[model samples]
Target: MVDLKVKLGSLELQNPVMTASGTYGYGEEYEDFVDINRLGGIVVKGTTLHPRQGNDYPRMAETPMGMLNAVGLQNVGVDRFISEIYPRIKKYRTNILVNVSGSTVEEYVETAAKINALDHIPGIELNISCPNVKEGGMAFGTSCPSTIAVTAAVREVYNKHMMVKLSPNVTNIAEIALGVESAGADSVSLINTLLGMAIDVEQRRPVLSTITGGLSGAAVKPVALRMVWQVAQAVKIPVVGMGGISNAEDAIAFMLAGASAVQIGTANFIDPKVTEKVIAGIEDYLVRHNMTSVAELKGALQA
Candidate 1:
């Protein structure tokens, strides 16, 4: 059998398949559909310094091949997450990656420090790219300075592995990637969601309550792959790529494009078992290609 284990910063994942934030909930919700331990890691929903009720109703809308979400980072506060959700998930065998968000640099530091004090949580994915909210959502991530400042502030507090999730809604993604790297991020994940909108001409209104939301699904695969490839080349730190990944082939594509690991997002909405299937598919590809280790495929792209 081929070895599928990989590393994201200093954390070791059983495989390259991890569940993205927001889509996977708190990791315990999907326990019935699939064994959570089988996954490399679980990136729980975005957690803030204070509990947020999120935006109003009709926050999600389906597009042609993708979906738009303006959920506004609805999540329990860090205190609640530790007092409630963390205890239950601590028993799981996989690495627990808390997906954290903040409206300001101070919030990110406080949240990261709190999670760092936790015994079971292994790392944190700084969600600097969420596009649905009004404050500090894509604002910090779109610019290089803000990204560096926020990441550096959090880095000083959170000693554990930290992966900075990047936004695709930028002019030069490579500059942002390098900025995070300089700020001491252990690794980076990309292409959070493309900014998009849908209009209901007949109703003379927008599909989502927020008017515009982040677009995610198979339609975004090509763009995501390109960004990941570019960021990987620009940074020495590991890159965890995600976008429209739905199958083993897609996962392999990301690995070859320079992703140290990959996360499955919208695909989970379609099939809860997608991550397991992707792991299996990767194994099959490795066996067929006579590859001994999956790590060899990292950044194997040709000129």
Candidate 2:
């Protein structure tokens, strides 16, 4: 029998197929279309110490093969998430990882501390890589110094597994990955949407409110795969690959590239059942390849 289980830091996922934050609400929203328990992990929407209204409308636009979005970081503050959302998802059989973000280091640490208090939540995905926001998001993720400081600060209070999400908008992504890994980050997930923009020629205006948004979908798969490969080779910790992953072949490709696991983002919007399908496809691929476990595929690239 093939084993699909994968480990991220101290958390053991049933499989590598997890729903990315923001794409999948608290896991309850897709209950009708997806079997939440079947997923390896569920990363809840990005949360801050306080609530955020997010950016203005016209936050999303369609590009050639991908989509651009500037959703800001709209989320019910951590308090509300714990009191309201937590109770609902705490019972899921899979690991429930909270995607934490903030405007400042203190806020990030404080938020991480709060999430640490939740006994049911096994881990937190630190999102210093959100491009839609003006303040904290990508700013912290792009700078190696800020990456080290914020992660180390949160490490003090957050006892559970902590995964740092790296932004694609950077000069040296691999360097940033190494910095976070050294700063007590248990793991790192990468290629958080690339910065992009769309324009309306006739209207003579930008498509999104922020004028620029994070590009995601099939268009980003190659870039995501390359970045994942680079960071995975550079860091000792596991790397969670994401960006434009839409099917099982894409997930497998990431695994082969060196990602210990992967997060399904925009694909969830297209097909809520995509996670289950990817899981099944992985199994089929394993069988066809005569592999016994998914772990064997990590960094298995022949070239």
lDDT of 1 by residue, 77-143 (tens): 9999999988888999998999999888888899999999998998999988743244534578998
lDDT, residue 67, model 2: 94
Q: Rate the local accuracy (lDDT) of all candidates.
A: 0.91, 0.91
| Candidate 1 lDDT score relative to the true structure | 0.91
- Report the C-alpha lDDT of model 2 over 1-303, residue by residue, as the tens digit: 899999886899999999898899899999999889999999998999999999999899999888999998899899999898888788899899999988888889999999999999999999987432445345888888888888999999999999999998898899999999889999998878888999999999999999999999999999999999999889999999998899999999999999999999999888889999999999999999999999999999999
Per-prediction TM-score: 0.97, 0.97
Clash count, candidate 2: 1
**Where is model 1 poorest over a 10-residue stretch in terms of lDDT?**
129-138
Q: What is the clash count for each candidate, in the order shown?
A: 0, 1
What is the total number of backbone clashes in candidate 1?
0
